[model samples]
Target: MKKYSPELINKLTDKARLLRCHVVEMIARAESGHPGGSLSAADMIAALFFHKLRHDPLKPDWADRDRMLFSKGHAAPLWYAALGECGYFPKSEFARLRECGSILQGHPDMLKTPGVNMSSGSLGQGLSIANGMALAGRIDGKDYRVYVLLGDGEIQEGQIWEAAMAAGHYSLDNLCAVLDFNGLQIDGRLQDVMNPEPIPEKWRAFGWNVIEIDGHDMSQILAAYDDAGEVKGMPTIVIGKTVKGKGVSFMEHAIGFHGVAPTEEECKQALEELGCG
Candidate 1:
């Protein structure tokens, strides 16, 4: 694991805050998009795209690049924010989120967006797709890894367990799944909806190397990613405990913000809170 300097940590935290601002603001501009999960995932995605993932934004189709599948694609705002921040596209595209003729859709569309390795939002199918990619990499003798992000509620689907079983059975050491365990979903708390508690134990039972950490903590997130690189003989799942709407004070853990875009007034307030201009 790499020990990050205070300067590097500060930079990553700034990026995360910037991405969170972009997510909420862009959603506000479009007047439609998921904000809660998008904001909650900002720190982790910022760290991954800017500090960890092996890919060139200038060359999105580089054959040897690592694959990233966002299983919780409702958080398309977050994905787009990270991609834009990474230079996958111009920062100007952020304002067009969810608009007609915009590549940034309500959900990630692999064919429409660069840097999105696979389309998602149907919920639990992403792990299966990620498994296929990892298996293919092994068959083709490629060293590139596959990373997937799943929402806590999204795992309520039985298909998730099935995919987990497949990944475990194959001993896909190259597959790393990140669970954004923010507790709150669109409806209410995850336990009230469909409890997937004992999350780490469950993954371990599926033959995964489980690592639990604060999803918003840059240092822990970085360490988890590094640890994933060293694990062998099994897939790894990093369970990140986070708040529903992370940076925006009003939205944090507020279920109302799950799929509701902020109004212009709300946007101004959110930006003020995020220290964004």
Candidate 2:
């Protein structure tokens, strides 16, 4: 694995914290949004947008730019925060999240958003979309890679398995997916709701190169991305084990926060816990 310097790790760590703060504030402002999954996936998103993705914010539609898709699109707040922080759009747009005409919708909308590669909300479709993109890049002779973020809960959809089979069959080495494997979903814990355990083994059986890591660890997250790039014959899936609603004291692993936005008091407390109060 490629070693990352402490300075780079620290910078990405701080960026993840800031992104978490943004997720809380944006959801609170909207009065409704998914926070648990967003928080769970924040660190990975931070590593991708800041350290790994190769797209120009100024040229959101650059032909040869790398593509990042959010399969679990309810985590739009986290995606918006990353895009805004990376200069894809004005950070001021965060406050208007989920508003009637805001570009920052409850789920990603490629038509409205600048950096979004896919308009995704319904579960189990992102991998298929990513497959098409990866194949297109190959046909067009572009070197850009495609990355998709999948929720552990979302994988319960049978469509995900179909996409997995297809990706394995096609040998999509240019595609890499990160599973935000936080245990809790909106209904309850994944095991209680519908277990998708043995996740790594399942992906490996499907011909994917699996790399498991602590989702919140900056070093491991960066290292996983590096390792994915080295796999030549199949796609890679990093199953990042993470806690739902990370960073905030009250929200950590709290299923109640899955689809509910924090109130003023809760938001204040969450910001304080994140050191942004």
Candidate 3:
């Protein structure tokens, strides 16, 4: 594992802030989008695109490059920002979010969006897709890793468990499922909606190596990715305990922001709080 120096952590933190800003502003501009989940995933997304993922922004379809599937697809704004910031396309395209003819649609489309390996928004299905990709990679002897970011609530779908079981059965070590365990969903608290408690034990039971960490912590996030890479003979599932609508005073842990866009004033305040004022 590489050393996570204070400078590296600080850089990732700044990237997260920029990512958060993009998510917040884009959703605010759209006036009809999900802010909570996107904000919560900002740090992880930044770390993946800017550091962890072995992707080429210039060569979106380069063979042997790693793949990322947004299993929690409604959080498209976040991925759009990351892709843009990472140079898959210009970050300027973010202004066209949800536009009728914009490349940045409400949900990610691999055909429309460069660098998106799989078109996903349907919960529980992304992991299965990841498993398939991982299997294909194995068959081709490609060393590229497949990462699937799943929402905690999305795991409530039976397909997620089915995929999990398959990944474990095949010992798909190249497959890593990262859960955005923010503890809240569109309706309300995740526990109140449907508890996926004892999460670590459940994954271990299914033959996965679970690595729990503070999702917003840059150092921990990087360390977890390092650990995920070292895992062999079994898949890795990182349960990132995050806060829904993180970094925003009003939105943090607030279920209302789950699928609601922030107002212009709210966005201004949010950016100010994020130190981009």
The numbered model that scores best in lDDT is 2
Give the candidate number with the greatest TM-score.
2
Candidate 2: give the clashing pairs: none
- Residue-wise C-alpha lDDT for candidate 1, range 1-277, written one tens digit per residue: 4687888789999999999889988999999889999888888888888888899999999989998889999988889999998999999999888888888888999888898888888999999999999999999999998999999999999999999999999999999999898998878998998788888888899999999999998999999999998999999999999999898888988999999989999999999999997
> For model 3, how does the per-residue alpha-carbon lDDT over 1-277 read when each residue is reduced to its tens digit?
4579898888888988988999998988989899999989888888888889998899999989998989999989999888888889988888889999988889888989998888877667899999999999999999999998999999889998899899999999999888999998877787898888878998999999999999998888999988998989999999999999999999997999999998899989998998874
Estimate candidate 3's alpha-carbon lDDT, on a 0 to 1 scale. 0.90
In order of lDDT, best first, we have 2, 1, 3
> RMSD of candidate 1 to the true fold?
1.1
Which candidate model has the greater lDDT, 2 or 3? Answer: 2
Write model 2 residue lDDT over 72-189, tens digit each, in one string: 9999899999999999999999999999999998899999999999999999999999999999998999999999999999999999999998899999999999999999988898
C-alpha positional error of residue 260 in candidate 2 after TM-score superposition, expressed in Å: 0.4
Name the runs in model 3 displaced over 4 angstroms: none
RMSD values for the candidates in order, in angstroms, are 1.1, 0.8, 1.2
Candidate 2 error regions (>4 Å): none
Q: Which candidate do you rate higher for lDDT, 1 or 3?
A: 1
Error of 3 at 171 (Å): 0.2
Note the residue pairs that clash in candidate 1: none
lDDT of each: 0.91, 0.94, 0.90
* C-alpha lDDT of residue 240 in model 3: 94
